[model samples]
Target: MSSIGTGYDLGLFFSPDGRLFQAEYAYKAVENGSTCIGIKCQDGVILALEKIVISKLLKPRANPRIGSVGRHIGIATTGFIPDGKHIVKRARDEANSWRDNYGSAVPGPVMADRLGNYVQLFTCYSSVRPFGVMSFVAAYDDLGPHLYMIEPNGVYWGYNGISAGKGRQIARNELEKLDFSTLKMKDAVKEAARIIYATHDEEHNKEHEIEMTWVGEETNGIHTAVPDDLLQEAEAYARRTVEGGEDEDVPMNE
Candidate 1:
């Protein structure tokens, strides 16, 4: 018989049932489930998450997966990707239905609120049980980027910026230096990668995966940056200030 532990509040979501949580769970493997950061820039909101992916049942790695659940809103995730995909699929389908009926994309903030509600429901019934998952949902609306933590029980809170997976402490340390309110989309993406790269272990041979989506007044649509381009930009930004290749502090003046 499989012994599932009691419900734990490690953050991603609360589990009503107790079960044996893995090391990743002990560390609250749920990325943004613990802390999130958000910056409302002049152009729009920039939301970022730690690049680590961890769980008791999963291996350690960097998985940057983000998407637009609605036409105008985007979500950046830092947790069990399968669950994130599950949530995204449902959200996207619902958004599409709304668009078909309304003839326009649903607003970003509204999409986030709806998604958050769904997460809450998921947590209530699923978090503490086996095969539970945690997630970070970063969204944008008229205001800017809004960050949140979604548990298996279906509860989530809107936050600014957050880190998940492994080495988030290192990521958070880097995030502390930024003035989020003035950040622009371009600079925000660069900084997001810079922080993650800084915290990642170079000894490990793994694909440096990252995905960024921008939505706001200028480009209120979702656009995925090429990994190579993003790396080049991130390196250049770091070179400006640091003695190394780039400074990583290039401000978005726009």
Candidate 2:
């Protein structure tokens, strides 16, 4: 059944088999996937995550891993890592397409919206299978900061802010305390760092560092990884809250 849609383009229609947005892959045992937190701001979006990768036997990988896209969209993924990488690639591809179609100089907000729309379509393609990848997509939208929580099922929810992985519950709880609607950009970053740090401490985990990405008017499509010094400061702050800090002093910037 095809229905005409008015407003923008009427040349698009959805098909089940044409695009299956489902995760049909086996889950491999891995040590760490990703720990991420996002903050929605008036100017832009802030996202942070710790990368922990494990070998086939569930042992931590020797080299640290950091997943980024187009230097603008920062994706900290959880769940199926390989799938996460695939998702990142998919996002990058969409970003490139938007650049090619609209112009090489697409705005950050436009890029974020394009990514979100792509994720939705991907989900539709997957149908009702199992999706192994889930990620926190934080970027700037025309209205300001745009945050989205993307699941493997292709179901994405626009959010003021979101966090993923082991420490998400702790981060979410902490985010509730802050007035996100009126919070400043700097405050949002610090809060995200604080919650992630607290989340690691509450779990008695050894991983201490949190990765971050920010998109704003100045930054445009250029996403900068958090500096090492700043992550150390955030870790110190998170440590004070709980007794005996055991979180590793890994550099947040990878």
Candidate 3:
């Protein structure tokens, strides 16, 4: 008989080898979700996601994977969308509470820590299961651009560039070659689009759309969706880079 079922029945129980099967399962859910990316550059932070379009009748941009939490903070999530939405709501609440108590917007690290604690609680109790989602939080604060990734296990970390979900490995490789200290927001947007386009699996994910948002100096530190004109331009550039076999020479400065 397999020992898989011996201790995997409950999230609160630990297997003989000390593995938390429930949390691992939650991570699998995230791995199966659409790809989401976050990058912190000199001028600002960018959040992007490849949204899998399930139906032709569905309205465009109806189910966005990226959302703004506060004036300067944005979140991109991948996994069970409902679970992701729950986290988004909690983040928004935390931001509002912080502003009410401190008379200023909540910082990125503080928000990530609070959310990490909240998510970690579910893994410790038997009554509730872990949240099936991984999220990236991006913000532009007084200290400059910040990017953080929160996992289903409640662990979180600050990153210059990070990617989650199906195409994470490919996206990570692409991000590793960039010079973040000099990377501008415009180039970051194009890079984001290129990464998403490169990672999309046509056989598995037939139809998809790119969702990108940013908080930067140009926007006066306000979080907002990438404008339609710029978004279209980035999409065009990304298509050329991916389809033209110019992956090795992606334009970083231009």
Candidate 4:
């Protein structure tokens, strides 16, 4: 039976279709945000993002769409940036807690599952609004580099490569053409950057603004920004492809 609510606007009460209106709204928000890409490759994983700062006064952030959760685990996000941050912070906490308790880092799928639980708790009550965010997490472990996408409603999926946010369909379509089964670490990063440049609108399509990394053996992967020099190289390749320019060094792979 449909229960009566306080009759407020845009509340997250369950409807007959087994859907939460507020959660659907949050998904819509993600659909309209900047694009983020994550790919699981033979050697490791890579992430790429579109950078568009409205104010010229604001300095650029390398990983605006990405955040490190632990040594080996990282998350790429899109939608309301703050909500993404919140999810990132929680992922870090969970990772740290695992290390402290079991003396081991949490695996990628486990971390995603735990975070999904946290997100679902809020939906139990109408007082808290669902976060207007979605995350694509890249993690490495015994399974090697793993890619997973989680929605605001606690749904998660594993993928070889995935894209989210504004123009994501286009980006994903482009990404599907690449052979992730054979993609190496270096090439994966470059291809990710190309996808961002190829798909993002002119405003956010800035070269070298993307963040990337790979998972390695041992505990978790290092939670640091991908080196600037290599990132610059990838960005340059992307710029050439996006603008349809041809230089000896630029690869017109798009």
lDDT of each: 0.54, 0.57, 0.90, 0.76
lDDT of 4 by residue, 184-252 (tens): 777776788888877767674444355565564322356456667777887888778778785524443
Winner by TM-score between candidate 4 and candidate 1: 4
Better of 1 and 3 by TM-score: 3
Off by over 4 Å in 3: 1-3, 245-254
Kindly give the stretch of ten consecutive residues in candidate 2 with the minimal lDDT sum.
21-30
TM-score of every model versus the real structure: 0.66, 0.67, 0.94, 0.86
Q: For candidate 3, which ten residues in a row score worst on lDDT? A: 245-254
- Residue 82, model 2: lDDT of 66
lDDT of 1 by residue, 106-146 (tens): 76555656766765553344343322344555445555555
Report the lDDT tens digits of candidate 3 across residue range 48-84. 9998888899898777778899889998889999999
Against the true structure, candidate 4 reaches a TM-score of 0.86
Residue 238, candidate 4: alpha-carbon lDDT: 76
Compared with the true structure, the alpha-carbon lDDT of candidate 1 equals 0.54
Query: Best candidate per lDDT, number?
Result: 3
| Predicted candidate 2, C-alpha RMSD | 9.2
Better of 1 and 2 by lDDT: 2
lDDT for model 2, please.
Answer: 0.57
Q: Give the Cα RMSD of candidate 4.
A: 3.9
